[model samples]
Target chain A: MLKVENLHAGYGGAEVLNGVNLEVKAGTVVALIGANGAGKTTTMRAISGMVRPSKGRVLVEDLPVEGLAASRIARLGLAHSPEGRKVFGPLSVEDNLLLGAYRHLPHFLGFRSKAAADLKKVYDLFPRLEERREQLSGTLSGGEQQMLAIGRALMAQPKVVLLDEPSMGLAPVIVQEVFSIIRRLKEAGITLLLVEQFAKSALEVADYAYVMERGKIAVAGTPEELRKDERVLAAYLG
Target chain B: MDTSVIIQIVVSGAFMGLVYALVAYGFQLTFATSKTINFGQGELVMLSAFFSLTLTRLGAPYWLMVPGGLLFGALLGLFVERAAVRLALEQKSEGWILLTIILGLLGFSSAENIWGRDDHPFPTPISSDPIHVVGVDITPLEISVAVGVLGIMGLIELFKRRTLLGKAFEAVSADRDAAELMGISSTRTVMLSYALSGAVAALAGILVAPITTVGPTMASALILKAFSVAVVAGLESGFGVVVVGLFLGGLENLASLYLGSGWREAPGLLLLILALALRPNGIFGKASIRKV
Candidate 1:
């Protein structure tokens, strides 16, 4: 459902993503794993229009969306939960979620009611969020914030979701909980492109996976095939 | 001097202070969304009042003239955003400060050409005769200023709190990138803020014009005091501006009464310098913590 072709992007004259190519087909979880500074995050950002690509194309449902404004890309049904869980700090959790559905919901009155069902779905996925719906999102724990980020992305009901570093800065227990939520999302048939530091867990949940090196994809295979690659096992699994 | 006389001066001054609060609120609006404010806001005030005066002279009723003036102000605001702010913000530069100031100067010259250099009395159906209430005399014109200022402020505040679009505005203010991911356009939000700021400035002009008279320079002193209020109260809090505006107004009146009439502008300047030196973030503003 989402495709990237020869994407080249960077900040200021320093190219971080050089001719990186990838795809996330409908109803499958694709994990992009690599060590620090391997351009995984930049690739996600370029795909979502956060960082404009220097060259190449990004397609959401086969429509070229390269160089569009991030909000325009979002309205076209691509939701990106960026690194750092950049939730609106002063807003309540419910407001953050409602805004995630901004393109679909009414701009003025009755938006709360229109978003009621999506809110319920997210709250069901993370009951902790429901309990703290009225609380300011900034005060939430890291794990809760991660859940809110993921929940917020889901609120958009987008065609594809790019989730970057969902496990960053969390306890192992919380990371496990996050993965379980990912598993649930996958089971529910959501198309996702996940970037992660934890290769083992990512491989376990991914239907297909790509290992990135420098600024390009180094290996691509099914998760089962990836698990048996000696080089992949040595560098990442170890 | 009688205590009642002192009460009258403070009360009257407080009403005028509310006008400053209204203009300061305009600065807060644009600052919230884009972190940029129009340096030409005083000119916007003066121009809108002149426009309303022309409308009155053209035989438009007060009711029709008010909305007409506000709409004109909103369009001028959009012009400022497009001409002065949008490019600078996109390029991530502070060039807007100079650009808006230049635009204000152009507006000042234009007003001179169109309305002439002399102050003109603003005609109003509302009588200026003071009404006696609890041993104090207050004019309907002054009461209308308070009501208009507070009414518009209340309505804007309500829009921000109760509407989804308003929440989206707050979202952009809090985090621009995250808001974009949510499909909220920060550029449009900034535009909306500028438009609202312009409308508010126009309302301030309309409300105070009857008392201060309509002239190219009418808003010069008022804008300075409003700037002081915005700085002292902090640009983020709506309620803070009103409180600080009222306090500064009363203090200035008392200064003029006791320390000579020439001292009218002293308190606002002193308060501004004190706020800058002691509380740069403002009394109501939270100290921002940079998380690396």
Candidate 2:
């Protein structure tokens, strides 16, 4: 389980996440849907230890990870597949997947072979990646790049996976494909925290959803509950 | 002017440019990894040269100096990464670019005090005897430089391809936030890049020392030339940098002979300006586009 309580975060002096509360229960998919700058990304950053909360606590399996470095937090099995598909352009598609298992290298700790096996599993998930395994990632099409991004994250074998705007800039068909992958992850019993601007699509797949506005949560519920809510429909589902 | 003299200047200028590309390649490494520029790079070269000279002067076999220079260079590189690069990362300021420049100034000036800043002839390990290639007299020094820089390029390629750490460097450079999510340590990657930068600078320093001079200001021209080369090459393409480095080098030499020596800096700088104006991304650099 992951918990963020009373979280406060910002860039420079402008607060982006204020007293925000959220959680992803084990084996559940929680989609955080919001307007632009509604603190969805900021909230994810805080949870993944990318940004330190000015005030709050982040508990990973009840372990304090609020102010820890991201790598440290990642060891606790929380991995974020960031917005904008930040795959290494010059490296091969295969190498990009390998990098997602970086913490396993240099000490093995029985993780090297495990990471290798997990990487092969990622290749299975995205066979196009395996076909273009030797090609430089930078040259991949946007849809392929998004697939590569999710594939790379899965290589980490994370306990809780965070996706920020995976559907951004991708084609409608590709977006549907990516959301299908998210849906599949939930089917596989993985805990997921997804932040998306495409609220309607996100809530459709989200088991539990939160609608954020101006750096705070406006509403929260199960997918069915939020789907029927008038405010959620008017403000976010549109 | 005689044809041979013009040819000599042109050939030498081009060869010198290859050396400049070698130095600039160092800058490209750090810039790619962390987006932090190490202004002290020139001093790193100069210091390496002095290390080589001191070792040779101490009667250490010339063969020992190669690895000796590289080892010493690597240490200096590790030091710079820790002391200078770390400061910039901690402050979250690219402003530490000035810190590296200051480090270079302090380093170069202190070296001047220690080594007296006098022009000292360096013994070239390879033959200085001229060999004619295409009716042009080229020394073993130029050939060695061409080989040395090319070797460095090959090695860096291998590092990025074959090594686990090199991929880590690439991961960090591609997207630091995403890299962290993958559990990649940014500090380690940046340190690795800087160390490689220092070594590259040292490689350039050691090779150019014999051709130019072993002095406190030994690498100043080399550093400036590298800056120009990197600017023209778009600061991204490593091999592209080497090609541009050689081209500008040759162009400068040709310009100096046909027009005047004063026009030497003019062409390289002009090329840099023209490149930026036409393709701000650089001759070899690809533009980065944000998804959102």
Candidate 3:
């Protein structure tokens, strides 16, 4: 559903993503695992148009989307739950989810009724969100915020979702809860490109995995194949 | 001192203060979305008033002239954003400060060239005759200023709180990147704000033009006081500006009455310096904690 061909992107003159290539086919979870500064997040950003690629192509459903504005890319059915759960701090939780479906809903009135079905599905996935729908999102705890972030992304009903670090800065128990949510999503057949620090958890949920190092994909295989690779086991699994 | 005299002074000054609040609200509007305000807002006020006067002189009815002036103001605002703010913002440069100021200077010269430098009396259907309330005489023109200021502010606040597009506006203000991810364009939001701000500047010009007269230099003093209100109230709070604007207005009038007309501008300056020294974030502004 999404493909990146030799994408090169960076801040200023310093290139962070150099000749990186990957793909996420429809209805499968693709995990991107890498050590710090391996360009995993930048890869996701490049694909989502958050960072403009200096060179190469990003295709969404075979349409070239590289160098497009981020909002334009989103309107074309790509939802990126950016790093650090950057929810609108002052807005109500329900408003955050409604904005996820911004492209589909009406701009002024009756948006609530329009977004009812999507809101219901998201609430069913994370019941806690329903309980705190009216609360300011910034007041939510870390795990709750992560759930809000994921739930917000799902609200888009996008064809592809790029989830960056769903487990970052969470307690161990909360991390487990997040992964279980991911498992549920995979079972529900959502196409996702996940960038995660926890390789073991990511591999377990991923249909396919790409291990990145120094701005390039070092290995690519099925999760089972990645688990058996001695180098993958030594570097990531260890 | 007679208590009624004090009330009369406060009542008049408070109404004038509402004009400052209105212009300050204009600054708050653009600042909310783009973190940048038009330095030439005073010029915007003067030009819009001048435009409205021309509309009146062209034999347009007062009601017709108001919307015409507002439209002209919104277009001028869009011009300012496109010509000044957008490029600087895209480059992540602070050049907009200088650019907007230059544009304001351009506006000032244009107004002088087109309308001449002399102050002109702005005709209004609203009466200037004072009606006695308790022992204080209140002018219909002053009452109109309060109604206009509060009425527009109320409508905007309602729009922000109720509409989906308005929610998107707040979303951009809260986090530009996240809003962009949701397909809400920050550039457009900034444009809307500037347009609203320009409309607001026009409204202020129209509402106060009768009382202060329309001239190139009329907005200079008004803009200074508006700047003081925005600084003291914090750019984030709509209600804060009204309260602070009223307070500053009253204080300055009292200063002029007791300490002489030379002290008229002193209270606003003092309050501004005090707000800067003691509460840099403003009394209503929440301290921003930058998370690394």
Residues B139-179, candidate 1: write the lDDT tens digits.
99989998999999999999998899999999999999889
Pairs of residues clashing in candidate 2: none
Greater lDDT among 2 and 3 belongs to: 3
Which residue ranges in model 1 land beyond 4 Å of their true spot?
none
Which candidate would rank higher by lDDT, 1 or 3?
1
Q: What TM-score does chain A of model 1 get?
A: 0.99
Model 2 lDDT tens row, A1-238:
9988889999888888879988889999899987888889889888888887898989888988998888788877888888787888878898888887776654223434656778778877788998999999989999999999888878777888899899999889999999889888888998999998788888878889888888888898899999899988888775
> Taking the tens digit of each residue's C-alpha lDDT, what string does model 3 give over A1-238?
9999999999898999889989999999999998999999999888888899999999999999999999999999999999999999899999999999999999988998999999999999999999999999999999999999999889888999999999999999999999999999999999999999999999999999999999999999999999899999999998
lDDT of 2 by residue, B1-292 (tens): 6888877787788788888988888888888878887888889999999988999899888789878998888788888888777877877877667778888898888888888969898886688899988888999888888898899889897777666677777778877777788887788778888888888888888888887889998887678778888988887888888788878888888887778878877886788788779888788888767655
DockQ of each: 0.91, 0.46, 0.87
lDDT of 2 at B278: 87
CAPRI band for model 1: high
Would you estimate the TM-scores of all the predictions? 0.99, 0.87, 0.99
